[model samples]
Target: MNRSAAEKEYEVNYYEIDYNEKLLITGLVNYFGDIATRHFENVGGSLTYSKEKGMAWVLYKWNIDINRYPKYGQKIKVRTNAYSFRKFYGYRTFEAFDEKDNIIARANSIWLLIDTNKRRILRIGEDMYKIFGLTKKDNKPLFIKKVKLPEKFSIEKSFNVRYSDIDTNRHVNNVKYIDWILETIPLDIILKYTIKHINITYEKEALYGEKIKIFTELKKQDEEGYISLHKIVDEKGKELSVIEAIWGIEEK
Candidate 1:
């Protein structure tokens, strides 16, 4: 079954917004994930089918840019497409648009299909490509700069993985990592700036009941904006994920 991109519409709920009444980044990510799953199901890769086959697609990296945060009660449309596939990787794009059809946020991501039973990445066969309607493309890199860890972190905090943080996959959901990273950011930056860009690379997974530490460094700050780096590590200090964030001055 060949299909183009798929889309879904959603309304920003009151619970999805932050204290400032703007949609939270994690809420937007939920919408993106929902659309991607629905699109895959539309293409015949239903969650049930994948589970029965002991297969699952795991996020490897994220590059998201937000133009402006949508307010509560606003309606937005999300679109996603599986654009390219490599041996063991899939490349996809997602966009969120306002009621006026203007894009408010866009993201590019990399995913790896893995054998759930074996816990290893599986090669993308021709069948997988046909199912997703993916075509080969030139390997122009999707990301310009890689997410880098800070040379030394100034602030660090540790937390135990909560049951609620675990998703259907039996591991902490990707978005939960963002929540952990945000906790270490300076309160001043969180209050005075709005996140405009985010880049995250997943290295490992965290399971329930495990303790994890987040190290954050405010690398740069000026009149225009701020840059923050975060690293999540397991109890043994094993790297789980690294993130870089860019924030712009909040409009007064």
Candidate 2:
């Protein structure tokens, strides 16, 4: 694949920014989603397969690194391309850049072709693989570190799903889950810090009207007062997801 290919540009909209006037993390995910969907449409692939078959492309995992966040009025270009494929999964990469072409963020994700009706992973059909033109590569993805739950982590808040939390798939969207977890922290803490890393695992789907309990624990705080630890639990008290968020004071 040519890394120098012209990047696909997208205009920033009012709805895409958060109260802080920067693109929300969820908004960034949606942009990537849009790019992937358009790529499929160009190749004559179906984007609504999940709705038709009761199966959808559920995000199994993702690792995102951002050098800086885009401001509200900035016009950014997001370039995405599929690099490789494995049995039931396809690997893809994306880059978000400013109009001047400075890279702002990059991500690598693992997507599972799922059978929504049966709630199981579906094998990648040969026809689907051919459509995307993906090949096997010798390089491996960055191995995300997993942490074991401490003996005594506790729930901070419990929330019930509102209509707004559900996406077209009738399940909680990946970014919404992140928002929910972040909301558990104090606003003062959120404003004073910058996220250095986040590692999340999607365990199961939480449907509308399900009551979810969010559990969090402070595993450690460094000399600079940066916070890090495990976050988990959903409405049913089941382990819906696990995340490790590292934070540091924003430099002056």
Candidate 3:
């Protein structure tokens, strides 16, 4: 029970930036995921170890807030901490800091440990707890604000999942949903605004070659900016994931 967090430094690269020179959402999430993996590996939780035990971690929910997107070539430090553990869930937090040490973004995520063989959630074991250096159990409820689907979607798009979309988990990677969510937004909105906040809840997995649909609704613009709600479903209309995003004009 010594170390529980890990940190890394990154410089934004051209490939990770969008047309406006701001880091893409996917790129930021990649950094967050990488640090989480590194932290676990540092604490004796390696992929080989998990595979040997037929165990893997899967994301359940995420809530991220950004003060501003990091620009291309900007150097920033990202850190992830394993703060708490419940029976079947792990609670982790992430923060990205600019060169000035200002926290540019913060995120909290929930993950579930799954038995790869049975493909069901597994309760946290004492050994796993020891690996993360966590001893105290968190009794307080961990919550993710519900993302309600709009009654009527203003826009809809469909895509067939591709092999490249699959991660080691054999399903669409969690970050791929962000691309699908953004695809439903209009070009004007994407060009005019930046994602300020995003909340996503995963309900089901999308497999390769499955036809999935995304429905989006743009709510009325308020002082903060625009809010968009999205729902992802399989061809049969089975809900897979729900997302809520807030977009705002970037402050110079």
| Total backbone collisions for each predicted model | 0, 6, 0
* Top lDDT prediction, candidate number: 3
RMSD (Å) per prediction: 1.7, 3.1, 1.3
Q: Write the per-residue lDDT of candidate 3 for residues 1-252, one digit (tens) a residue.
A: 457889999999999999999999889998998899989899988989989999999999999998988999999999998878988989899999999999999999999999988989999888877898888654344577999776898898999999989988888999999988888888988998989899999999899999999999998686657999999999999999999999999888
TM-score of each: 0.95, 0.85, 0.96
Task: For candidate 1, write residues 1-252 as lDDT tens digits.
Answer: 446479999999999998899899999999989998899889888889888989899999999999988899999999998877777878889999999999899999999888888889999777677787655552333653688676898999999999999987788999999999889887887887888999999999899999999999885666888898898999999999999999996554
Which has the greatest TM-score? Answer: 3
By lDDT, highest first, what's the ranking? 3, 1, 2
- Candidate 3 regions exceeding 4 Å error are 138-141
Query: Could you arrange the candidates by TM-score from highest to lowest?
Result: 3, 1, 2
Cα-based lDDT for every prediction: 0.87, 0.70, 0.90
Clashes of 1: 0
Lowest summed lDDT across 10 adjacent residues in model 3 is found at 135-144
Candidate scoring better on lDDT of 1 and 3: 3
What overall lDDT, based on C-alpha atoms, would model 3 receive against the true structure?
0.90
